[model samples]
Target: MALPIITGFDKGDTMKRILTSIFAFMLVLSLLTGCGKKPVIPDDDDDPIPTEFTAKVIGNTSGNLMNGGQYAEAGGWVYYSSETFDESTLTIATGLFKMKSDGSSLVKLADGAYRSINVVGDDLYALTQDGVFTMKIDGAAGRILPGISADPMGMILVLDETIVFLTQSGEIYRNSIDGKNPKELADVNAYGFYYQDGWLYYGINDASYTIRKVKMDGSSTTDVSTGGRDFVFADKRIYYRNMMDNANLYSMAMDGSDVKKISDVDVNSINTDGRKLIVSSFTGVRVLNFDGSDDTVLSDEYAVTLSIAGDFAYFVSQDFSPQHNKLSLSSGTLENILKVRRIDPQNDVVMGSGISDPYIVRMGDWIVYRDSGELTKGIYKVKTDKTSKTKLIDAYAHNLTLIGDWIYFVNDSLNNYLCRMKIDGSEKGVVIDLPVNDFVMKDGWIYYTDLNEIKIMRAKMDGTLISVIDDSDALGEIKLSQDFIYYQTIGMEAGNFGIHRIALDATRKFTYLDDSIQSFIVDTEWIYYTTKVSENELPMQIVRMNLDGSQSVVMDYFDEYVNVIGVGDGMLYFETWKNEAGSVNRMNPESGQRQLVFTSDLRNDHTVIFENNLITLKNNEDGSVNVYLSDLDGNNRLLIVE
Candidate 1:
C-alpha cells in the first residue's frame, strides 16, 4: 500500500472531493460504454447455479496474500493480484488477474495497486490507492465509486444495495451501489465492521474494545457488548472471537445478550456457517459446534485466512512457503489447491511501510540480506541483477558475513547468539553460545563483542579456541583490518570516546587513533570517521586519516551529526540528520568537496555498497522498512525483494 499524507479531517475532506470527481468521470465513461443501466442484481432465477464447489474467493490478493489476508473468488473463477516480489522492498508489484478454478484461461483484470476485493452478485468491488472501483465479472466497464477518499481497512461489505466500509481513522460510511447518496453512519473509532438484518455491527478501538451496532439508516447507535475483534453473523446470533480472551470464539444474541464462550484455544482468525465454526489457531485448523462442542482438528499445519464453500474449508498456510489448501468438511480430508509463488523482485516494485532493521552483504553473485518486516521477517538472497531470489533461512537474522562454505549471523531468538549455517541452510548451530552485539570474521576466526559480558571475544570457525580479547565494558562497533582489530570504546571523560586498534592476537594494548568519534569506516588506505568537536555543538566533522594514523585531515563537516556509510568510487558516503529528515551526502576524500545525493524521511544508518549501487534500509510510515537500491549518485532507484 502506498503511504498517504495522513492528516485527520483535512485528508478526509480532500479525499471526499477527489472521490466525487473521479466517480463523476466514471459515470460518464460508463454511459459511453453503454453500462448506464441500474446496478445489476442477480435475480433469483438468474442466480449462479450453486455447484458442489460453489465457494468463491474474495478479498485483496497481493497485499492480503503477503500479509495473510483473503482475495476474491466466485463462479468457478478466482481473482487475485498477481505481483512480482521486489527483494529490495520485500513487497510485490501491483497487478490484478483472474483464473478458472482448474487454473486455466487466466486473464488480467486491472493494472495497479488494489485491496479489499469483494464479489457482489455479478460484479466486483475493490479499493485502490485513489478510491473504490467496480467492474463486471469479466473485467469490463470498470468505474470508480464516488464520495470516498479515505482508504478502507477491511472487507467491503455490500448488503441490501448499501455498501459499507471503514476508514483507517475509524469512520464508517455507507453508500448506494451506484456511487450515490453516501452517508456517514458512525465514527466510534471503529476498526472492523459487519452488516446484518438492517443493522451494522462494528468493533471499537478503545481500551475495552467493545462491539457496537446501529441501524443501516445511521440511527440509534448503541453499545452492543464488550470485548471482540471481528464479527461473523450466523444462526440469528452474532458470533465473534474475544479479543480480551485470547481470541477464543464467543457468540451472543442479536441484541448483545446471552454471551457465551465457545472455545478454549487462541485463534488467529474465525469464520462460521450457522452450524459450525472454522477457526485458525496456533494449534492448527479446527471445526466446532456453534456452542463450542464436538471439536475436531482438521490440519496440524498452521492456517492463515479461511472460507467455507459447499463442503470444503479453504485456507492458506501461515508458513514461509504459503499454499492454498482445501479440506473436505464432511470426509475430513485435505488437498492442495495451489502453491502461491513468491514475487520476483527484479521485475517488480513493491511498496510498503513499517519499522525495519535490514542488513545486507554481498557474496559471489548474490546479495544476502535480512528483511525485518513485522509479518515477513527472514533472511533472503537475490542475484546481483535482482533475479533468482531465494529465502535461505526463515528467521530474523542480522550481521551477515560469509566465510568459506558457512554463513555466520546473529540470530535473535531468546537472546542474540552468533550462529552459523551452511550456505544452503543446513547444519545450523550456534558458534558462540553467548549473546553478541556485533561480530566480524578474519583468517578463519570470529571477533565479536559479547552482550552478556560486554567484552571482546574470539573463537575459531568450528567454535574452538575461545578467548577473551578485551575486557572493556563499553565496546562499540568492531571491524577487522589486515593485522589489527579496530573498534570504538566509550571513555569516562569527554573527548575520550575514540577509535582504538589492537593486534589481532591480543598481544598489543589499545592504540588510540582518533578521539570524540561518532562513527567510522575502514577503507584500503584511509579510515573515514565522524567526530564531534564538543558536546554543545550540533555540527560534526568528517575526518580521514591514513591507516597508520598519519596525515589526518578533515574531509567535510555537516550542520547535524554525520554517520559514515561507506567509501566507494573515490568518494566517502555519509548520512546526516536535521529537523528529523535524513540526507545522503558524498564527498571527495582528497578534495573535500561534498554534495547532497538523496533525502528521505527515513534515517539511513544501515547501508551496503554493492558494485555501482547503494542499498539502504529505510523506515516506512506503516511500521515497516524498505530496502531501496540506487546508483552511486542516487539515481535509477530499484526495489529488490526475494
Candidate 2:
C-alpha cells in the first residue's frame, strides 16, 4: 500500500513551510547535483537540529490477492491457478481460476489441479495433474493431449494453427493449438519471440540473448543479432538500448546489418506513428525523423512515458512540482508548434502564488475554480475565456458547487469550512464549515459523508460550520434535498464488506439498506449501486437499488468482472474486464443500458473525475503508469499531454 496523503503535507502556506525546509535539505542533495559544498562542523556546545517523522498507510489491497505463477493472455481472460495456499498449514493446489481484468467476474475453470496455462485464439491449453489438456474459454469440453508432457510456459505464438512453446527444462517444441505435430527446436531456452510477416523472430538464451529467424516451415535458422538488452521491434527494425556503460539506442535492419547507435544517455521508450520516431526518457520527449536526425524535445514537462498518435504526442510529466507544470509541445529541434495548451490559469488569490486541483464552475461570464494560493487552500475566480484571475479568500476549498453569483464549496483541508465567492473573483465570504465527503447539493443544504458518518449541513452563502444533523452511524455518499438527506453505510463483517443506510436528521434511526451490497449510490427516489454474489467463486453482478433500500435489482451480469464505480450526468461509469482483457464502460443510471467507452489489455489502476465530456484516468500501458483522458461515450481516444 502507498501513503494516503501526498507526503502527508497539507497544500498551501503549509507548502511554503515545506519550501523553506528545502533550504535546510540542500546540503544533503548536493551530491545528486555533482556539487561539493563546504561543510560546517557544529561546536560541542551547539544544539542539534531536530527532525520529526511520521508514517501513514493508504490504499487498501486486502480483498484482491493474486497467485504467483506463469500465465498467458487470450482476449480478456486469464487462466491461472485457483488453488488456495496456507503457508503455515502447508496447503496448495493447481486448480484453474479464470478471471476478468477488473477483477469482477471470477470462476473456477476446472477441478483437480494444473501446473500452468497458456492460451491462444479460442483454445485454453494447460498441463493438468492428469496430463496436458485443452479447453474452451467458457469452460465447456476438455480433453487431454495424449502422451505429451506439459510445457511450463505452454504456448508462445501461433502460425497457421501451429503453436510454439517453451518447456521448463530450456527446450522448444512445436505443436498444434489442440496438441499435435510435436517436435523439438534443439536445446535452447527461448525467452521471447515475435512473429512478423512470414518470418518468426525469436530470442533465445544461447551465449547471451541471441535472436534467430526461421521460416514458417521450420527451415534453416539464421542469426539476427546477439549481445543486446531490452529489445523491441518497430518500423521493420529491431531497436534496443544497451545495458553496458554509456547506454544508447541502437537499431539494426531486418537482416541484422548496418547496426547504428541513435542516441547516448538511455532512450527510455520509442514508438513509431509511421512518420516520426517518438522517443522519451527521464530527460524529456523527443521526435526524430526516420533517418535518425532532426530530433526535437517536443514537450517541456519532464517527459517520462509517451505514445505518439498522428501529429500528437501523449506524454506524461514526472515533475509534480506545484509551481512549474505547464504542458507544451514543439517540433523541429525544440521548435514544435503548440497544438493543445492546457492552461492552469491562476487567479490573484494573491500574486506569485501557486494553485493545486482547480475545481472550476461557471457563473455568467466568469468561470470559477477553487484556488488555494494565498488564503491557505481558499477559493479563486477567473473569466471563462482565461481573461482575468483573482483570489477570493484564504480558506481550504473542497466539494465546490456553484449557485448564482456565489460558488459553494467546502474548505476541509482545515476544519471542514464551507465558503462562497463571486464568479468574477470578488465578494468572497464564508458560509459554514462542516465535515463531509462525497457531498451533493439539493434545495439549500450540502449533504455529504463526514468521517464515517453522514450529515446534512445547511449554511448561508458565506463561510461557517453549520450542523443540520450529525448521525453517529457510519455513512457514505450522501445526497441532500430540501426535506431529507439520504446516505449509505459500509462496515466490515469479519473482513467482508457490508452495507446499510440512514436519514440526514439525528432523530431518524438508521435503516437497513441491504444485508449484502458491494457498492451503491443514492439520489432522491432512485439508488444506483453494485453487488457481488460469488457463484462458482466469481462475483458477476452490477446492481441497482431504490433510495429506501427496497427493490434492489441486478442491472448487468457478466461472466467476467467489473470494478470501480463512478457516476456523472445520469450515467454510471466503471471499468469492466472480460476474462483478463480490461475496458471501461458507462451505463445509463436510469435504464441500466451499457456501452464500452474504452478498452485495452493493460493494467488501468486509476479512474478520476468525469469533467467536460472527458474522464481522466491513469493506466499502465508500456512499463510505466501514465495519465490519459477518454470521452464520456468512450469514442475519443486518450492522449499523452505532458
Candidate 3:
C-alpha cells in the first residue's frame, strides 16, 4: 500500500488527493516528461537493450516491490493487490491477485486488506489487517505472525534475508521476513522512509524534511541530502525530488555527490524496477525509463499500481548544469510534428511543429497525411495493412480535421481557403471561400479562425449557414469542448492574454481561467494549459481546468518556458525551444507528469534517441529540414521525408 502522504498525514485526505489528480493524468493516457532539467546521467549506464520489461532491460529477475509493494513478481508470476476504500468504515478493501508476465492468465490468490506485498522463495508475504501474513503462492496456509498489530502502512523491506521496517509512529528496525526477532535500527521519527540495497533513506518529520540515510543495522546514520522526498534506489543511483529545484526529480551518487535532475514534476510516491521507474504525483501514476524517456501516464485514477503493459523501450540519453539555460531563438534548424508558421499576427516566425493543423490523422489502419515537401507536396492516404497509397488532393492542405466521411482542411494551394474531400479522393470542393487559420471539425460542424475577417467563424458541413461566434480579441488555437469553444486571447502584455470560451449555441461567452493564462489546449475532460508567472519570464506553470472552467489546478512548473505543443498518442507534448537547442517533453495531461523524450542539439548528427519512430531533426545545406521516422535498432528504416 502506497501511503499518499508522510506518516503524519491523514489517510482519508491523502486518498482524496489521489482521487482529484486523476483528471489531468488520464488526459495524457489518451496521448505522454521532464521535471526541470533534461535528464542528465553523468556516469551513464552502459548499453541500451532493444525493448522493455525484459530481464536484459531491467537486468534482473522479474519484479520487486515497486509502487509501495502493492505489486511484486516471483516464481515466474506477477502478484498484486487491488484495493478499494469504504467510506462508511473509512477502510480499504483489498484482494491479492496474480498474472502471467505477459499480462495474461490472471488469477486471484487471496482476499484481504493487503499492504506492502512481497514474495520470497515458496511463500508470499504481505501486511494485512493483522500483522505480517504469510501464505503459499497458491493462496493456502495463510497465517499472520503473532504480537504485531494490523498496521495499514506496514511495508516489508528485504535486506540480505533480514527484513527491515519503519513503523508509523516513526521507528525503524530490522527483523525476519516472518516478523520475528525484531532488532531496532533507528529510533528517529522519519516521514519518508525507504529501503534499498541494505541502506535506509528517509527524511526527518519536520518542516525541513531533511534527507538522510543509514545502514539496515542503524549504523553510519548521517545526512545525505537536503529537502528531498520520494527516495528510491536503482543502478547505483539514488533518485528523489529536489525541493530546492522547483521540486523536480533528481538523482545522485550513493555518497551524495553527482546530483542530476531526472524529471520535472514533483512526486509524492515512487517505485523502480531497476530499469523502468513508477512515480505517483498529483496528476497520476507515470512510467518512464531510467534516463526519463518513454515517459507516459500509466493511469488516470490512483491505483495501487497504475501498470502500463510492455512495448516500453530502453533509453540511453545527457549532462547539464544545475540552473537551466534557455537557448535564445533566431533562425534555427529544427523538425516538428506539424511544422507551420505562427498564427500570431505580430510575430513573423516558423515556430516549432504543433497540432494547430492536423498534418496527420489515423482512421483505423489507414493513415492520411499532409505533405509540404517538394516531391509529394499534397495530401496522401495510405493503408497500413495494404500497399494502397492515394494522393487525395494534389494541393497543400493545413488545419487537417476529419469529420465523418470528409476531410476538412485549409487548402493552402487554393488561396488558403477551407476545402473538403470525401474519405476516398472524390468530391473535392471548397467548403468556405475564405482565408482560414487554425480550425476543428465535429458532428458535421466547422469552427475556424477566419483570417479574412479576423473572427471566429462557424459553418455547416456543406458550407452553408455561416456564423461568427466572436469578433473580439485575436484568438489562438481554437478548440471545442462540451458546449463551449475555448480559444486563446493573444496579447503582447500580461492582462491582454486570456483564454476565452464561447458557447456553441451562442448563449454565453466569457474569458476562461485568468488573465495571466499564456497558452492552453482543450481535451474531452479538461483544458490543459500554461501561465506566465509574475516573478519569472520563462513560462512558469502548466495548469488544467475542467470543461465548465472550474477546478483549476497547477500541474507542473519549469525554470524555463515550455511550449504546450499538441495532444496526441495518449499524452500532451511540450517543447522547450532554446534557439537551435530544444527538447520535447511528453506529459500526462491529467497528472502533470512529464518525461523528456527528444532532445535536438545542432552540434550532434542526431540527439536523444528513444524508442520506436526515432525522431531525427537534421538541417540541410539550404536551411531546410529532414526528419527520419525509424526504429532504434537500425533495422526498420520505415519512413523518411524532407
Candidate 4:
C-alpha cells in the first residue's frame, strides 16, 4: 500500500508514467473517434436507472485475487480491464472489457484501467484511473460518477444504495449511488471490503492484523479477528487466512468464537463455491473440501490471485508474461497463464531532523527513532540487520522507551501525553492523562517526572496506580537502579540542589546521595556520579559510592565536569567531558582511565544504549545531523535511517 503523507500515499514514478502514457493514448483515440455518441452515465438524482433494469445478481469477484481484484467471471463471461488516465483531456479511460470463458468472443465494456468492478441490475460500476464510473454491461452509455475521485488504494464495495471505498488519501467514504452526499466512515489503510447482513467488514493493516466490521449505518465498529483480506463468508462462517500462522487457512464462528485452524496449506488468495475452496498459491491452483480435506491440485501453474463468479474461477500467473486463465468449477479444468530495501548513506539520501539531539530507542532488533527532516519526518522503525524499515504512525513522537511488548513515547502532536502501542504499531492509546516531563521504566512500572505536577510520579504499565512518589522539586531526569529511584532535586526555596534516591518498592526510603551532582548513573553495586570541586581551577571529581554507604572513593578527576551518558558492558562508561560541546569518551571504571572515542554536543543527556550498541548523532555542514549506530568503542558505525 502506498502510504499517504504521514498517512500519505506514494503514487511513485511508475504510476505517473503509466498515467502519462494513458493520457497520450486517450488523446489520439478521442481525435479519431470525434462525433461518436458519448457514453450515457446515469445519475440517480438526475438520470436514474431505467425502470426495466433488473439490477442483476452477478457476483462481485474481489478479494486477495491477482489483478488486485479487477477481474470477475460471471454470466458465462470473464470480465477484465486495463485502462489509464489522460492528463490533457482530464479524462479516465475506464478500460473495462470481457471475454468468453474459453478466451473467445473478446468484447470491450469500457476503456482503460478499472477496479472495484461490480455488476448490479443492467449496469457495471467501477473505479478508473481518474474516478468512479458506471456503464451498461454491454459497453454502452458509460459516464463518470458525479463527484467521486480516483485511484482508491483499497477495494471499494457497493452496499445496496450506498457505495464505500478507501481513498488513496486515507479515508473510507460512503456515498449514495449517484456519488452524492459522501460521509466519511473511517480513516484507514484498508485493502478489502464486504457488506453482508446489515454489517460492513473490511480488512485493515494500519494497527494490527485485524478484520473489522461495522454496522451498515456506520455504527458499532468491532474487530472481527486476527486475519487478513481474501476472506470469504459462506455457510454462516468466515473463512480467513491467518497471516501470523504462516498465511494458513482458518474458520471462525460469526461472533469471532470457536476459531479452528482449518489447514496448514498456506495460500496467497482463496475463493469458495459453497462446499469447496479454490486457492491460489505458489505451488499452483488447488481445490479442497471446506474442512481442508480431499485436497486436489487443479492446475500446477502458480497463481497470485483467485476470483470466482457464477460457474467459473479466474486467476493470473505470477510469471514474466502473465496469462489470465479461467477454470470450470464443476470440471476442475484450467487454461491461461501469465507470469528492500536497505539504507546506503552515499547513494541513498539519509535525512535528519536538523535537530542536534535525535530521540532514539532500541526495541529488540529494531531501532525506533524520531526524525523531523523534510522528507522523512515521523516515527520509524528499522531492523538492526538493515533488512527493513517501516513507518509506524504518522505523528510527532518523542522519548521512545520500550516496556514489555509496547513502545512508550510522548505524542508531541497530542499535548505531549505519554502514548504507547505494540511494536507492530497496533493497539495505540494514550497511557497517561497528564503530560510527562521525562520517564524511565522498570519491571512494569513507569516512573517519571510529571510535567503538569512538576514532581516525581509512578504508575503501572497500563497507566493505573498513578501516585506521587516524590513531592520534591525534581530536576534533570529519572534513573532506575536495583532498588532505588535516583533523581536530582531542589527544595521549594531552591536549596538542597543535589542528587537523591528513594526505594523502588513500597518502603520508598529517601536518602540524600550528595550535593551539586553534575551527572549520575546507577550501577548494580555502586552509584557513579560527577561533581565539581570548589575552585574553578580544580579538576572535576568523579565519585563512586557503594549502595550500602560502605565506602566513598574518588574514581578520578577530569579537566572539566562531565556527563555520564551511559554504562556499557561491565564497569565501562560512555561520557561527554566539559559539560558542553565536547568529545564523547569511553572510560574504564576499574582503572579510572578515559579515552576520547566519539564526538558529542551533549544535548546534556544520557545516550540510548541497548543490544550492546549505542546511538549517537553526527552534525553535517548543512546543519543536518545524521544518526549512527556505533559500537561501545565508537567504531563500526552504520546509518540509522534513510
Against the true structure, whose TM-score is highest?
1
Put down candidate 2 lDDT per residue, 1-642, tens digits, no spaces. 000011212111111111112123432443343222111222442221111211121111000000012233345655554333222211122356666543348787776444334555566755433345678777878886643443322223434345554454445555544443455543465544545545556666554557787664455578888755435566777765544423467778888898888777466545555555666665676667666788777654444333332234433334221111112234332222211121122221221101112254444544444433332344555543445656565555556666544455655443353444555455444343234454555434444555423433443223223465654344454544334555555555331234444344445544544445555544556666555566353556776766555577777776666664556677777776665688777888668788877775535444434354443434333322233444567665554321
Best by lDDT: 1
Which portions of model 4 miss their true places by more than 4 Å?
1-67, 73-77, 82-95, 99-105, 337-642
Model 3 residue 76 distance off true place after TM-score fit, in angstroms: 94
TM-score, cand. 2? 0.36
The TM-score of predicted model 3 comes to 0.39
For every model shown, what is its TM-score relative to the native structure?
A: 0.47, 0.36, 0.39, 0.42
Q: Model 3 — which ten-residue stretch has the worst lDDT?
A: 315-324
Query: Model 2: number of clashes?
Result: 32
Per-residue lDDT of candidate 3, residues 1-642 (tens digit): 222111222221211112212122422331221111111222543322211211111111212232345456655677766543222222224467777755478787886545456666667777654456778888889886543322334345543344444454556655544444455556666543555454566656555646787765456787887766556677778777676776677888877888887889776555565567766555655677778777776543232322222322111000110011111112111111111122122122222221224456556555566766555567777664435777787666767765556677877654466776677977666666666777866555677887756678887666677898788655567777656777775657553467888887666887665466666777777778887766468658787788777688777877766656555556776666545676667777657677776564544223222222334434455433344444332335444433
Clashes of 3: 27
TM-score, model 1 to reference: 0.47
- Candidate 1, residue 380: how far the Cα is off, in Å: 20
Candidate 1, residue 169: the lDDT equals 56
- Alpha-carbon shift of residue 96 in model 3 (angstroms): 81
Output the worst ten-in-a-row residue range by lDDT, candidate 2.
Answer: 58-67
